[model samples]
Target: MTSPFLSLPGAVGSPVAQHYGAPVAEQRALDAGDAAVDLSHRGIITVAGPDRLSWLNSMTSQQLLGLAPGVSTETLLLDPNGRIEHAIRVVDDGERAWLLVDEGSAEPLAAFLNRMRFALRVEVADVSADFAAVLAFAGGTALAALRALGPVVEWADPWAEVTRGGTQYANGEHAGAEWSAVQLVFPTERLGAVARAVAPAGLMALDALEIRAWRPSRVADVDERAIPHEFDWLRSAVHLTKGCYRGQETVAKVHNLGHPPRRLVMLHLDGSEGELPVAGALVFREGEASDPEARPVGRITRAALHHEWGGIAFALLKRSVPADVTLAVRAGAEAADPQAPVEGVIAAAQEMIVPTDAGATRTIPKLKRL
Candidate 1:
C-alpha cells in the first residue's frame, strides 16, 4: 500500500489522503505559517459571456459585479431551501469567471448552470479533468517565490491574482498567514513544469493544515443536513447585501436572529486508544437516550493524531454541549456477527473537549479595496 503523504521542501511533507481528506500536520502548517494543498481533485466550472458577471451575480451570494481582474471571492451554491449545495471560490479574470469547488459538486453544479442557460449566452462545463490546481500558503520566502513567478494582479486580502508570463494564478487562504490558492492550466503535457514550479503534495497534508486552521470541508467533515451557518462559511462566503439569490432569505434571517442549531468545533481527545471515533460516528455529551439518535449533539467529522494535542478532531456539535463536555464514540456492530454487541459503547474511550478559540471572532474588511 502507498503512504498518505507527499514530499515537499521546508516542511515534513503533505498528504496523499483521498481528495476529501487533508492530513493534520499539513493543516497545522497552513494555519501557523506556510503550506500548500493539491486541489487537482477540485471541480472547476467556467462561465463566459457578456452576461456572465450579471447572471452569476443574480444567482450566488457574492457581489460579482464589482469583481475585476485578478480578484476572487468565496460563495455558496445554495439549494432553494438555503442549504448549501456546495461552497465555491470564484475568480474573475475580467473576461471569464472560474468556479473552484469540491470535487463532488462538479457534475451537479455543471448541470445546474447548464440548465439555467436560457436566453443568456452562458456556457458551463466541468473542467475538472483539464486543470492541475494547487493551493499554497507563503509569506516571506514563499511569497517571494510566487511573486517571482508572476505579476501580482489583484487583491482580496489573503486572496489575490498573480500571473507569470501569460499563465494566471489565484491566491487565497488554506489556513491563514500568507497564502495562495494557485491554479495552473495547460495541456496535460505541461503539468510537470507546473508541479515542479509549485512543488506538488498529497491531500493528507492539506487535511492536516485544514484541521489546525479549523477549516471544515463538506464531505466526511460535515453532515449533508448541515446549514451553511453552522460551518461558518458565511465568514468568508456569504455577502450581507448582494441582493436576492436562492436562499438569501434564510441566510439573512439566520444571520440576524436565529442561531444555527449546532456549530462546528475543534475537539481534543483523551486518546486512551482502544477504539477511537471514526468519521461518521455519533458523539454524545453525557450518553445516548438523553437526546434523539437522529438528533446527536455532534458528529465526528474529521479525526487525526496531532503532534501537540495527541488526538485532535473536528466535530459539528450542538450549541448546548458544554465546551468541556466528556463525549463518547458509539461503536457500530453488524447483525448476527457478535464478537461483541453490534452497537457497543466505547466506554469513555476519550474525552472530547473543544479547542480554545475554535469559534473566535474574525474581522473582515467591508470592501476589496486592496
Candidate 2:
C-alpha cells in the first residue's frame, strides 16, 4: 500500500507533510489558491442505509437528522463525563453519508457505529483504503475540474459563519470568518493522476492556514481532558437544542449554569528566543526574573511559524487567565523529560479566541434573589 503522493518530487510525510523543499514558497502558492495538499493520510468512513441520518443525530453533538445533501457539518463524540472523544467531519451525498476523520480513527469509529446499529437499517464501512482526500484552498478551478471527472464529494467548511443551533463565543472579527477551505474525496486510484493534474502544496501550508484561522483540529487540539466548551467548538460543532445524546447533559449544564474550566487562546510568540515552542510546552504566567517558581497556567496544543505572522500557537489555559495577559512558553526543550527543563522561555501575547463569559444561555434568566 504505497502512497502515490510519495512518488511526487519533494514528497515528505509523517502524520502530514513536513514540507516540499521551499516551505515558504509552497505556503504562498497554497494561500493564493494555486496548490492542493494530499490529505489521504486522513481516514474516511461511510454510513449508508435509511437510518443513517437519525442514528447519527442521536449520537453526536451536532443536529444531523435534517442535514441536507452537500451540506458540510461537524460532530463530536463525547464521553458521558463530557470529555471530547472524537470529532468527525461529515457530509451527505443523497445516497451515502461520509464521515471524514483523523488518521487511525476510521476502523474504531466505524466499528462503534456498527455496534450501535442493533437492528437499525444502517451499515458502516471503513472506506479509507478505497478513497483519497485532497484539501484545496482557493482551488476553485482545479476543484471544479476534478468534480467533472467523476463523483467527487466536497465538504465546504462551514466555519465562516455561525451554524444554526450553535453558539459563537468570539466577539468581533475572527480569522475563521474568512476561512475558505474544503475537503475533496475521490477514489484512491485517482490520487497520483490528480496530484499530477493539480498544483501540489505541502502540509505545512495547510497547517499555517488552519492555525491562522484559529481552527481547532481534533488530532492537534483534543487531549484526554478536552471538552467542547474549552475550544468554543459549539460555534460550529454542537447544537444547543439538539435531542439527548451522550454528554448532552454536561453540555447543557455547562452552557446554562457553569463555565468551561479552561479556554483556548491564540498566542503570538515574542520570537526573541529565536525558536518556536513545541506542542505540550508548558506555559507560565510571566513572572519576575528572580522568581524561579512561576506557576504554570496552560499547555501549548499546536505551534507553527507562519510565513507572515511569525510564530503562533494554540494553547488551552485556565479560564481565569485574562485575555490580555502576557505569558511565557518553554521552548527548545524535551517536553517528555520533566527534570531536564529547557532554559529558553519564549514570551507570548494572548489573543482571545474564547471569551471569558462564553456560555450564558438565554433561557436561564438572571436571578434577582434567592
TM-score of each: 0.72, 0.94
lDDT tens readout by residue for model 2, 65-102: 87899999999999898899889999999988999998
Model 1 weakest lDDT span, ten residues long: 162-171
Clashes (backbone N, CA, C under 3 Å), per candidate, total 20, 0
lDDT of 1 by residue, 139-232 (tens): 4233344344452132232222221111111113333333444443333344344345543334655554556555657655655576666765
Compared to the true structure, candidate 2 yields what TM-score? 0.94
Cα lDDT of all candidates, in order? 0.57, 0.83
Highest-TM-score candidate:
2
Q: Judged by lDDT against the true structure, how good is candidate 1? A: 0.57
Clashes of 2: 0
Misplaced by over 4 Å in model 1 are: 1-35, 140-187, 274-276, 286-295, 331-370
